[model samples]
Target: MVKDVFTNVVANLVTALIFGVSAYIILYIRMSGITQTIRRVIHPKQRVFALHDLKINGINRLEVSKFLSPLSEHERDILVKFHAARNGSNPHNGSSIRLDGISPVSNDKKEYTAHISKVGFFDFIATNLTAYPANAPIRSFRSQMATLMRSFRTFGLIQQVVNEVHKYGEPKKVEDVLENRSLANIISVSVLIVDATGRIGIVERTNKVAVSSGNFGATCAGTVGDVDFDADNPFESCGLREIKEELNLDLERLHFDGIVVPKQKMQPIFLYHASIDQTWEELFPIMEQARDISFETQAFYAVPVEDIIKFASHTRMTDTAAYQVWQYAVKNGQDNNWYKTLLLPFDVKRYLIPWNSQKDGTK
Candidate 1:
């Protein structure tokens, strides 16, 4: 009787083991199929923020949020004002942020002020280092500047001095070292304007004052501004804002070719391409309405899709991703890649552009 009972127990254990193995095999096969199916869903554009290399640090090492230590007092104030305006507060009215020293009250009271090195102030400029390839068009602009200006040559000398200082200066302030680090963590946005006529608006912008200025390969591109952007309408907001800023077009009637976020930190360049029915003469007056218009040196050119890549390549200031996006559009014909395919749904909110439009259609 004891032998019979023991045999029954062993048989039951064997059956359970076989069932568990079969279930696992079925589940694995289903998961593998699901992954491939997701990949097959292609997207038309890439998400720029998804690819950013954001490194979390011990609170002390957070560099992106630090106050602009390198800028002058006036410049710092301007940034603070910009931040305040974007955040719906008065710049002057805000409490003063004191750095370096702290005020000590009696044991009953404690005051806290944000420091210059803290990662939550104004004056931070985001930059993407990888997009600018050596000997690329951007370098050509630098080369031209080097040749044309005596001041740029002096900058080269200053770089040497900075290197020497780095070799000699002992570690003093951890904040100082962080300030000197030039890792650019900027966000890039592109808008493509397509008119009813299929003619796109392209600008030959030599204006360096524009945020992207000398580094970008394309025109009509800028970083996401200080304004709070909603994820639901990011494409419309960024697209329309760029159109109005760069081309002076009212986007109420325009159709946006959804936002394309890049894969690499700066892999997909922004090409806010718009199609407009208006010619240069008709659209010329709108240029004056721009918030920070830089007409110092700009010439309008309307080139077809076939020639845009070449023009952007020659411009030397266009975003590299712009060329790639245009190329993809041309090669793959519209059904290529979009943000949803390249990115997991959770990441979509961060990179999305908020949509905003004027109800009156006036300035």
Candidate 2:
């Protein structure tokens, strides 16, 4: 009888393993689209907090173009102001998150001045180390499982649930905050590359980007992340870091033509500017030198800004954030000069604009 019991146990173990493997195959085979599609589901855009909900971090030299360390005080604030949340992937939306939950907190990046919650971040700005292969998803199921080990052990979550989280490009440490969605804040950047000759730099993304495979977008745009910098400037860190990773340029070596601050009247709030030192003639060579291999870019074009406007209507070049930069640059002026528009009424206190400490101290 004992022998029969042991035999049954062994059989059950084998069956479970097989079932797990089969489920993994079905899920991963769909590739990165599944995760990005689900992200859209959770982070629907229209649900934006009212203008009052807008928390603006002031802009500084980092927004326009500076690569040196000891980034200006305003630049550091960009990355430092926002809280970091592990970008996890879970299908369920509208998860109930209470503000007055277990208030257990000490100090995290010093942004915990007001609201505090028991949960942590479940969203992420993927690091360059999480690079993809040319045009493939960042990783396959086996790889994500390896990283999820920490969470399984720490959070006491089972393989089935943790596996979903990892597969969705989220870190497992988020398991602690999985039940708390209110703490999540997603930060991303849209880079617009303009050369001296009035040509804008854009790329056709490969399947590696997950959601916008084959879409045309700003030169080397990406999102902000905790690893990008310990400093406070999110926009500067996000843009500069992405440039280093995707374009392979040494920030110290970059030549800045001038700062181009997008005016609120005509441009999206997210658009920030810094003209690269390289001229139009050298833009292609610079692009060819890109070091990040985890991505797949079909082509980099140095077409006239006007031509890009013509292509703007085409679905291929429709990354709104990036496109707005073109509108701001071309319409505001030709190129090669620092420009700033008077701060608009709506953007007075909520949006980050290049500010003068002595002049615009009203806020």
Candidate 3:
């Protein structure tokens, strides 16, 4: 009897050890998968293309023309219903600038003309909310719309409406997509502010914003509203207006770096390198008094130019913001070897506008 009891105790001990080990292995595998998924969502694959060969020196170098296209019946209905369901109230149907097409003038790659149209803000919101890539955290835009429609108790009808409106018709080139009139392509400006001491100013966006909330972005950015439309220099005026609203400082030395369109959202953002006369130390107190600080920015960091790539490697940044930093670094003669030292999240394809392709609307 004594021998039998001892044997039973040993068997139980072995069984418990095996069970614990198996459970631990299973948990580890699950945790690892979750970590990878989170990483992909945070840093989706992005491709940024440079629209101009030379740095656009003057504000007037870019030209604009108005080309309006009224929204379809289905789109209009989606805009109204989605806005009401999402906000629990009527939508703000403000005016916004939509990018239609871009063409170089007289075979000059440096000079270009942008065709824009006025679109309602609610229309942009309705379309843009479902414009994310397939691999995004929220899955494809179709899935997201389906979930929202179901939650709003209009699943069957709204799903059919959205399906028809948001169809990715064919596999087209990037240039074709940019000029596609069907998409709600809004034009926005991203200003990268460099203080007198050569340190780059980066701001952390708060959770109040609709898109890219809690992510690091440019110093100040906003859509091209009606107030920002200048007959002579609309893009420049938009950039300056955003800076004034977000930082409360008037910047006169803004240079158009280039235009970048991130593949994730497929939105073209005009990037400007703005220089401030004050050092970051002196600018801090003034920034503290910004009218929109509480609502837009959570905090600010002054990073030296050399540490930009390193800083970006460890921190999470919006796709446009990260590309802006990389473009600035490259333009400033930063060594390309440094970029290879660390693995970056996005792939940037620099396409120079060929002379022949300019008139044909080809890249």
In TM-score terms, which candidate is top?
A: 3
Local accuracy of candidate 1 as per-residue lDDT tens digits, 1-363:
999999999999999999977765554443223322332232212212221211111112223343323334464454444323222233222111112212223343232221222222232321112121111121233433332343233344334333533442433332232233322223335655433444344544443432333333333555543341332333235556765766566756333332223332322222344456665445556755676444422444444444444333333333334444455356535433333223433221221111111223442
Q: What is each predicted model's overall lDDT from 0 to 1?
A: 0.37, 0.38, 0.61
Model 2 Cα lDDT, one tens digit per residue, 1-363: 999999999999999999989866654653443443332222112212111112223322122111111223332222122111112222122211112211223343212211211111221111111111111232556655543443244332222223433343532221222222312323345667666766666666764453345666666665454454344554456677778778776553222111211111111123444566676455445644666623646555555654444333332443343335334555656441211121111221221112122235651
Count of clashes, each model: 42, 21, 0
Candidate 3 stretches with Cα past 4 Å from truth are 1-46, 54-92, 133-174, 337-363
TM-scores for all candidates: the values are 0.40, 0.41, 0.68
Model 3: lDDT of residue 30: 34
Candidate 2, position 110, lDDT: 19
What is residue 319's positional error in candidate 1, in angstroms? Answer: 3.3
In terms of lDDT, the best-performing candidate is 3
- Summing lDDT over every window of 10 consecutive residues in candidate 2, give the lowest-scoring window: 259-268
lDDT digits (tens) for residues 209-279 of candidate 3? 65556667777888888776554567788888888888888877578877776655566688888777787
Root-mean-square deviation of Cα positions for candidate 1 versus the true structure, in angstroms = 22.2
lDDT of 1: 0.37
TM-score winner between 2 and 3, please give it: 3
